[model samples]
Target: MDSIPVDFQWLGGAAFAIAIAVLAAWSKVFGKKEGPPAPKVQEFYASGQLADMGPVKELVESVGLVMQQMVRTNIALEETSKGIHHLVQAYEKHLAEEQRDREIAEEVARQLKDKR
Candidate 1:
């Protein structure tokens, strides 16, 4: 049987080329889409638009305050829910005790009527 000679150098080069082609195709399919870049602080200063920072700062502070208020409200709601749950349990226990007492009293009354 005649043996076919394999060239290692050609195989290595082909493998590298295929790897590069795969990477290029993958990037084209999944890379971030390009859009207009945001204006930098330097650009804003250069255009005499530095006054915009004041309103932006105020907006950030207001948002922070709102977030704090929401956190406090959530805590209050959780506490109220716990208190209501405890109250419901206590009321159920009281009702059960009253029902037992009423049943006992009715049984005693029936016994007395039978004795007469």
Candidate 2:
């Protein structure tokens, strides 16, 4: 195998240097021309309208709160129903006791009248 010719080696080095120079100049002139700077983190939080969700988020949050309140109210109503059932049972027991007492009194009175 023959060694590379000296002239060809020089030409190759020149071509590589020229390619590097052209690429650097092209990038300086046209590659991604600088636009406005990006917003800093704090500035993004402070200034952008997108960060402020206005009434839409509030409405959603209020709806969530209302749903929770409705659930609570339903639970309270269920408890109230249970309490009313207990009260009704208590009243029924009292009425049954009173009815038994009246029957006993009537039986005693009838027996007393027969003896007289």
Candidate 3:
């Protein structure tokens, strides 16, 4: 195996260190700083105004209204589905009755032809 030159390795390491330092310095100068935000609860309490607070009650009420409407719509949909099922059942019964009546009429016609 060929041995790598030591001087080239040292020069490469130095260049890497310089690049890391430059990046660190640039980030410190221009990067956005992160910290805890101002306390909204403290601001609202200190302001001594009820209107400044978050609308927790209003949000709850709106959610309740939405749930109520959803329940009502679901019930209406279920009733409509049941009505369609009943209509289909009635139509099937009517067809059966009509078929039976036609069979009876055919039997009477055959008896009349035998008499003639």
Candidate 1: deviation at residue 7, Å? 27
By lDDT, highest first, what's the ranking?
1, 2, 3
Writing each residue's lDDT as its tens digit, candidate 1 over 1-116 gives 84434667777778999999999999999986979988665677798888878998899999999999999999999999999999999999999999999999999999999999
- Model 2: lDDT equals 0.91
The number of the candidate with the highest TM-score is 1
Provide the global lDDT of candidate 3 against the true structure: 0.90
TM-score of each: 0.58, 0.55, 0.50
Q: Itemize residue pairs with steric clashes in candidate 1.
A: none
Predicted candidate 2 versus true structure: per-residue lDDT over 1-116, tens digit per residue: 98769869988888999999999999988887778999766554566765577677899999999999999999999999999999999999999999999999999999999999
lDDT of each: 0.92, 0.91, 0.90
Candidate 2 lands at a TM-score of 0.55
Show the lowest summed lDDT stretch of 10 residues, model 1: 2-11
Runs of candidate 2 exceeding 4 Å displacement = 1-52
| Ten contiguous residues minimizing lDDT sum, candidate 3 | 38-47
